[model samples]
Target: MTCQLRVLGCSGGIGGDNRTTAFLLNQNILIDAGTGVADLQLHELRAIDHVFLTHAHLDHIACLPLLLDAVVGARTAPVYVHATEQTIQLLRSHIFNWLIWPDFTVIPSAERPSLIFVPHELGQVEQMGELSVTPLPAIHTVPAVSFLLSSKASSVVFSGDTIGGTDFWQVVNQVASLKALIIETAFADKEHAIADAAKHLCPSTLAKELKEWQGTAEVLITHLKPGESEVTIREVLELDHIHPIRRLLQGEIIEF
Candidate 1:
């Protein structure tokens, strides 16, 4: 079966139609439970069984607690939240500590809670039906990872909020069937300094990162700050050697 990925939200911030990062994999899995998750109807929200987080940043995890709260009573099984041990720990310490939000993992009863954290190490691959999700290295302010989603036919990589680094490309170049690369360029060229300070990518930094890329995957830029989307995309398009780059839009879907 061909796997499908739907962009639930991809903006760096929230305003008007803009939403934070979130992607729906097929119908049952979520790549990140950002504000975009709110766009899903109640029925669609209830169908999410697994969520793979890239990091613990609020923009990436903002809607997770709400999603669980909305669906806890509707589902029979716990919602599986997959992330690195560090990310999971941060969620446990900060987000789900019962003070900020109810700790759904132990809510109602510990014997059968509404949510479960599934810890995955870097480079580990988890099989979910026809999809293979592999955690890839990422450079960010906190413990983070990218994801390589592969089916039997093709694959795509989501570089979840990363800076320019060679570690991610090392694994990305090895993917024999890569079809697309969904990456972040959170700032415009003028904001390169802020991008560097925040460990995010601007157009210039993104160009530098692409130097290590060797695959034929179509490049789709994501996470552009809402107001500067056009400027960032224009800068990315003006990059000297990179070809066929496009801005990722909310509601877009990619099949593989």
Candidate 2:
């Protein structure tokens, strides 16, 4: 079995020629269908069978309607959407409420809905073919989650918009074979006010958060606002070079 990571969208928003936050696991397993799904080839896109969401943020969930529209009839199996119960409710009420967009869950047929909801508890580990996934809590405007993904060759964590907590670091320190991390730093030093209000990571704060980590995985940064990516990255890189740090790029394919 092939297990690889395809970054569909890595930016915080659909700005600066970048798409919003989204990722694909082994091409068929999706994580947060942000605007980046718009870029997938039609045939390749139709092959997706699962989508794991991080939160109810518009940037993270924006592409669900569009993606469903694209592959509605083409999918042979239902697209399993896994998330916390609250996240699912928000998506159903706010996003797919028929007023904002048609509720795909009730579409076509109730028994064979295009999108299938699978409510998962935090810290519960589930297997999808060759992938084993666990959800970790994240601090955000709404209840959010980061993902711990493990395959035979390696394991990694994706911090989906968090403010860095003890639980997060505890989990990171426990993973023995973590190969990389894709964490967020959304604003520049000058935008500290905005970052604070939104509870997002600034470069300086992110540097402090990294102190908790002891693993040797590449500390790849992501979710920078449109134009502030470079400055924010430089600031975070200023920290002591214990682990390799780099900025994540859109469409970059990472192999374990």
Candidate 3:
């Protein structure tokens, strides 16, 4: 069977028709619980069984608490949230402290909690039915990671908000059957300095990263700053690369 991914949101900021990063994998697994999760109906929200967080950034984890609250009554089992140890700690200290949001991990009663935190390390792979999800290295303002989603036939790589670096491509180059690559380029070429400071990528930096990749996967850019998306895409297209790159759109689906 093929693994299907639905892009719920892929924008760097929120605005008209723009949403933060979130992806639905086969209807039950969420790659990130960003603002895009808000668009789902109550019944759709109830279908999420697992959430794999890239980091603890507000834009990435914004809807997680709200999602738990909305689906609590409908869920028969706890929703599993997988992330790095540091990311999980940040969630507990900041988000689920009962001050900012109710600690769903112990809410309704400790015996029947609504959420469970599952910590994963870099390079470790987790199996979800027929799909395999592996955490890859990411350089960001916080402890973050990219994800490699693979089925027996093909694989897709999601480079979560990160700077251009060799470590990520090192792992990505090893995927023999890579079908698609969804990477982030958060700023235009003119904002290269700002992008570097924030540990994000501009078109120029993205070009540098692309040089390390050897596969022929279809490249899709994501996380462009709302107002600067046009310029960013222009600069990305102007770059010299072997693979064709395009912007990732909300509501798009990719099956492999």
Candidate 4:
């Protein structure tokens, strides 16, 4: 198995070359179908067999419909989409409800539909190909969860948009082989109130969160707002002594 991960995008918002969040794992499984998925070539799109979504937010799931539409009949099997049941409801009620897009789950017929929904729960672990995926706790405005992607060599936890909490760090500290912690710090100190109200992290809270972690995973910051990227990253840089934190860039490849 090819134990590799490619970061397609990690921006908080779009415009001027920024794409939202998406990650391709082993070229066959996508962690999130954000706008970044648009960068994949045709063949690459067809190769995706599974997509695990962290939540149903637009930036995180913007390309899911387009992706399903792109690979409808070209592949032999349905593309399984994993998410929490609440997220599934959001997608069904808002996105695939025929008004917005075709419900591919039963489109060509239920027997051979193009997309499948797999409802997951916190602490649930799924073995997809050679990797083990688990949902971890996260506190977001809407219900959301982080993910732990593990291969035999190492593990990487991706914290989808969230306000760091004790429950989040509790699960993270248990992963003995964690190689990297790909997290979100969407705002800077200047936007702390906005961040708090939105249930997102800024540099200040990120530091408090780090104090609860008990692992050696390299911290890779993600989801910085376009205009605040520099400020947010600089604030995060001040916490390097806590956990080797750095900014995660689009198109970067992380291998384990």
Candidate 5:
């Protein structure tokens, strides 16, 4: 089996030409629901059966309501939303609230909701068909989580949106079977103070973070703030202990 990942959105915020963060795993498992989801083909839109939300940030989940609106009428099975209890509550009370967006849960029928929220505790793994996903806590403003997805042949982790931390690095080091790590680097080294204030990682901090991790897995960077991509990549290029440190470009596909 082939495990594919498509970058839907990779920037920190939306500009007239930039998109926020989102990614698709195996075409069926969506990592986030940023503005890029609007690019999905109608048929592709209808095929998404599961969404693994990292948090309730507007930039991370801004497009979910729209995506659900696009496909709710066509899905045979209810879309499963896997997230932390706190994150789910935020979505329910804020984004999906009847005031902001239509509560899709009651759209088709309340008895059998079209969208099912499955709260996942950090550190526990959930099996979804052929994919196994484990939610890991991420250091961010809200109750965010990163993920470790494994199939029979390969496994990788997606760091939703966070600064460098010991917990995620420790978990990655122990995952002997880890093949890749898609982490977020939102700012350049020059913006260290800004990055810190925003609870995001720049290349300088990311280099320090990587120094503490033990492994040679592919280090794929994502969530680069628009217009600062070049500087962030330059800073990453200066790091040691690993090679093939590639930036996660929007619309790019990765097979693990």
Candidate 6:
């Protein structure tokens, strides 16, 4: 079977056509349930069988509730949401509560509800259909994880919103057949204070983090803050790195 990873959104925040982080693996899997999912047609939404969230941040899971509401009746099985235990709880306590949104896990009936939370630990290689997904270490304000998605032929790692850590780079360094690294640099050098406070990355810190990566995969930067794209992009280019760096764009496709 052919394997494809499509970028539905990679922006730090939303405006105009820019959207928060989200990716589609083949047709049935989603990397995150961001606002970008709003663009998917009904048939496309119904095809989603699994959603892997990096964190419980609003930007990363903005569309999950709506996604379940849109596709619940169209499919026979509930959509599985895989994440760290903390993330799952936050989703339940904050986003999925009856006040904020009807808890889909009990919506129709608990026996055959529309959503299921599957908590996974770091480094667990979970199988979802044809792909093998492993969670990598991450340092963000809330509990978070980066994901390594591997098909038999090639692999890809997404460095969800984080201040890159030594363990993260160490694990990714050992991944073979890694084709791409979709990492984030969420702010400009001047706003690095904000980045550091939020545990996200800026060009300067991102450059420092890249030194730990000893992989050959092309680096695609994601999550640049809305109005500062031009300055951030320029700053990112001047950084020293072993691998080629490119800006991840919405609707971009990487076929491996």
Q: What is the clash count for each candidate, in the order shown?
A: 0, 0, 0, 0, 0, 0
Model 6, 9-34: lDDT tens digits are 99999999999989999999999988
Superposition error at 240 for model 6 (Å) = 2.3
TM-score of 4: 0.98
Model 2, span 41-102: residue lDDT tens: 99877988888998989889888888887889888677889999999999888889889888
* Higher-scoring candidate on TM-score, 5 or 6: 6
Question: Comparing 2 and 4 by TM-score, which wins?
Answer: 4
What is the C-alpha local distance difference test score of candidate 1?
0.93
7 in model 2: Cα distance from truth in Å? 1.0
Q: Which ten residues in a row have the lowest lDDT in candidate 1?
A: 236-245
Ranked by lDDT from best down, the candidates are 3, 1, 4, 6, 2, 5
Of the two candidates 2 and 6, the one with more favorable lDDT, higher being better, is 6
In order of appearance, the predictions have TM-scores of 0.98, 0.96, 0.98, 0.98, 0.95, 0.98
Quick one: RMSD of model 6?
0.9
Model 4 stretches with alpha carbons more than 4 Å out: none
Clashing pairs in 4: none
Per-residue CA lDDT of model 3 for 35-134, tens digit only, reads 9999998888999999999999999999999999999978889999999999999999999998999999887889999999999999999999999999
Query: Candidate 3 at 230: error in angstroms?
Result: 0.3
Off by over 4 Å in 6: none
Evaluate model 1: give its TM-score. 0.98
Displacement of residue 127 (Cα, Å) in model 4 is 0.6
Q: lDDT per residue, candidate 1, 180-210, as tens digits?
A: 9999999999988899999999998888889
**For each candidate, C-alpha RMSD in Å?**
0.8, 1.2, 0.8, 1.0, 1.5, 0.9
